[model samples]
Target: MQSKSGTQKIIMHIDMDAFFASVEKALNPVLQNKAVIVIGAQTRSVVACPSYEARALGVHTAMPVYQAKGIAPNATFIHGNFGKYRTFSEAFFEILYNYSELIEPRSLDEAYIDVSHLVTSMKAAHALAKEIQNTIQKQLHLSVSIGIASNKVCAKVASDLRKPGGITIVHPGQEKCFLSELPVEYLPGIGKRTKEILNQLNIFHIEQIANMPEKLLIEAFGRTGSAIRAFASGEDFRNVEKPEESKSVSRSKTLEEDTLNTHLIHAEVFRLLEECSLQLRQEKRNCDTVAVTVRFSDFYTISKQKKLNFTSNIEKELWPTTTTLLQKAMHIHKPIRMLGVTLENLYKTSQISLFDYPFSKVKNIQQAIDKIRKYFGFEAIQTGRTFQKV
Candidate 1:
């Protein structure tokens, strides 16, 4: 398909297929082709990702492990290793940087590459994608799906059209035809509710919306109507962008049962705070502000925050501050259904010292313990607090 002006905007979207689960498989080669699910070791944790084999049985990310197990009973579940995943992601991006500076990494496993400047020929783009895919599979043992198109939106959609170890190339002038054939829901950002609303208006496929009357569409959808109409027609003008460093890290969980028990509430709060701090450390970030949120059984929610004098990601230091906020926001008589902890006001350098306090010796010992765990693995040592659970 030739463009009207005979020039194409070459863009490619590459996404690792089932990234977390695939990483687990890569580390443990014996798990290849086996149904796998990545979850937290904690029984209450949610499934983060499911391999395609497990997905076939209706298992999916964000599902509770209990629910996922009910569906894919024979599937093997492994706790996620975020450290290893991040290392692999960084290496992948380092390789991407060699190809083009106009690359946008959407996540640890998804990125958009504007290769128009680098590879003028479609054949070269296809060949380059093959080489990149092979490199990842060989170096990382991870398969990826790549889509090439004239714009970012179509390229992203085309990438997902083909699953695990596949590529779809939509040459210029064919995007409209290619996109029109897809369901409106297939376009990004159209969620279940939006689909229902569009269906009510007899707008089932993208083709229908592309040709829909602009005035009537605007009256129905407000400000979003023009964007949606243009999107359906493959008129996306969004550019690939290099993402900024994360400014905050947080963790939250919903309890299966609304509980008024103080012990259980505190346990959940500590769990969230520990998880959030671990995430911040993984990103090499430290927080000076700690915030907590509590939602009651009736859905009323309250949040409180405290700013510390120094930045910290140490659980021992952060938990007390978070728990104090939790204590104030929660009423023991009310059954709380959800809890969240956020660490903000991130510090880029290890500029703050924990040794300034009068209790510096104790803090030093804790830091030593954390460093040991960081290198030797968490299972190498356990505190009396964790030992009680065992």
Candidate 2:
């Protein structure tokens, strides 16, 4: 079968298992085969990822640590270093791009590759997967699971059936049989609520939806239901694409409850600044602008931004700038429901200088802070702003 451009295609989904925990294990071999969970400093913090050993103990991504502790009391926990994860992720994608031009990064841990023109057979595709996995293991010391198929849906599902370092291939002619027996929940976009509705209709298997009458499915799920049916039948026509240059880097959170406290709002802005600054550094880009978005209890929204003289990825510098933008946008009209901080006007920088700071003293102090944060963990070194937030 040909894509809209009349090009035959083979698609592959590559996924890293419990990426954060796995990377920690790779860096410290002693952590291997031990239950591990990556989290932030807050007990209310969510689990970023859990190793397979932790998963067996009922630990899962996004579970609060207190719950995770109950599930895996003996598990080791690590506050993840996003800088390290992003570095490895970027290098991993570079290797993939060497083999195919059409690559889609779904997240920091998984991506899809369209290698139709590069390879001609299922056997060849399997060989390429092995080579990719081997290269990653050798170069990055991480394991990746790969699934090869004719389309995105099948490849995505196949990638998840088996955990780390496994490969599954779905031949073009066998897509239907390969996907039919799986549960409806296996299809993306069908969340817990939708699955309940489908289960009520006795349509638990993907094949049930594939064969459902279009009119009834549409009546039950609207246009989305029709799309899901097509997906179940292996009809995804989307093409794999490279990760787009980010238009903006942002951070936001749904508050536990609405509040009008300006101090709390300021604290939230600083936290966001820390995350955005790190993201900019990881992407090797600097921002010349800062923007703030706010949502109010009455659902009113407003935004404001400031153009900067130059971009820097130091949180201490960026936080103050971002705080000014947020203050301008906040009028205290209603309790705030959410807060957002963003960086834009991104440009790559290649030069590194130890003399950028005014006088040698400032530069030396900055270097000391960087070293402390790197070796002792980011939380080990914090600015006054972070303490005030606490």
Candidate 3:
């Protein structure tokens, strides 16, 4: 379809079919064609992903494992292995990189690719989509659903229409007609609450939303209403953005059990800080802002941040700021359920201060520590502060 500039744009959205479960089935032959549900290791973990078979039986992602077990009693429940899934995800993107450099990863399993430069017509786009599907199926033994449209919004909605190895295409100038008959929920950003409000207004289909008065929609949803109305009409001007470098680094952990012990909480926060610092140094980035987050047992979360005059990736240099932020954030005398450390306002690392020899020495020590941890594991070396138990 031609954009407003009179240039043809073809956007493709690819979503894997039950990604985590599909990966499990691909790796273990025994899981093929059987109902599979992937869950986390925590005792109170929920289903991470459920196969189509399990979904047919009413199981879904984020449903409690116990509830899923009751619904799909005979399904095979497996603990999720993120490392294995990441390896497959890397391979998935590697294949997409060969098709187009203008790719935006929505998640580990889904991405948006702009193939406007490669294909000349809708037929060519269909052929390219089929080729991509075949390549992924042949290489990964997994299925994907693709939606091809003039823009990202319609493409994402179309991709979900026919799932599990299906390709749906919306020809140029047919975006509104293609989406008109679909439910209002098919439009992006329409969640349960929004659907309830829409239902109250007797708006069940995308066509109703498209025909609504702009002032009424704005009144109903504030500024977001305009965007929702545009999406319902299959109008989205957003481009497929290339992946950008991370602006911040963070590490968080849910404690085994909530506790009021300040020592243990401090230790956990320090451990997370260590991880974030290590990641920053590895990326050759420095952050001038440090933030701490604490989640109470009641699920009440609070965060505090402090900005420093200088940026550094060394844990020792960042710890004082992190500690002060943590102390400020943990003022509520409640048992802590989780701890997180964040480093922000990042920039490429610059030359170290020549006059600050003490800071230079500490940086050298941290680099040595990073190399040792890279060869050995992170647990091979631990500071006294991180040695405490929860």
Q: Which window of ten consecutive residues has the lowest lDDT sum in model 2?
A: 350-359
- What TM-score does each of the candidates earn? 0.79, 0.80, 0.78
Pairwise lDDT winner, candidates 1 and 3:
3
Error of 2 at 74 (Å): 1.6
Model 2 misplacement above 4 A: 3-7, 252-278, 281-288, 293-304, 308-320, 326-339, 345-390
The numbered model that scores best in TM-score is: 2
Please give the lDDT score at residue 223 for candidate 1. 80
TM-score of candidate 1 on Cα atoms, chains taken together: 0.79
Please give the RMSD to the true structure for each candidate, in Å: 4.4, 4.6, 4.6
Evaluate model 2: give its lDDT.
0.82
Q: Which candidate is the best by lDDT?
A: 3
Model 1 pairs in collision:
none
Model 1 per-residue lDDT tens digits across residues 136-241: 8888789999999878889989999989889898877788899997998988878888899899998899999899988877897788888888889988878787
In terms of lDDT, model 1 sits at: 0.81
Q: List the residue pairs that clash in candidate 2.
A: none
lDDT, candidates in the order shown = 0.81, 0.82, 0.88
- Candidate 3 Cα errors over 4 Å, as ranges: 1-5, 81-87, 260-289, 298-334, 349-390
Sort order, TM-score high to low: 2, 1, 3
Tens-digit per-residue lDDT, 114-208, candidate 3: 99989878899999999999999999999999999999999999899998899999998999999999998889899999999999999999999
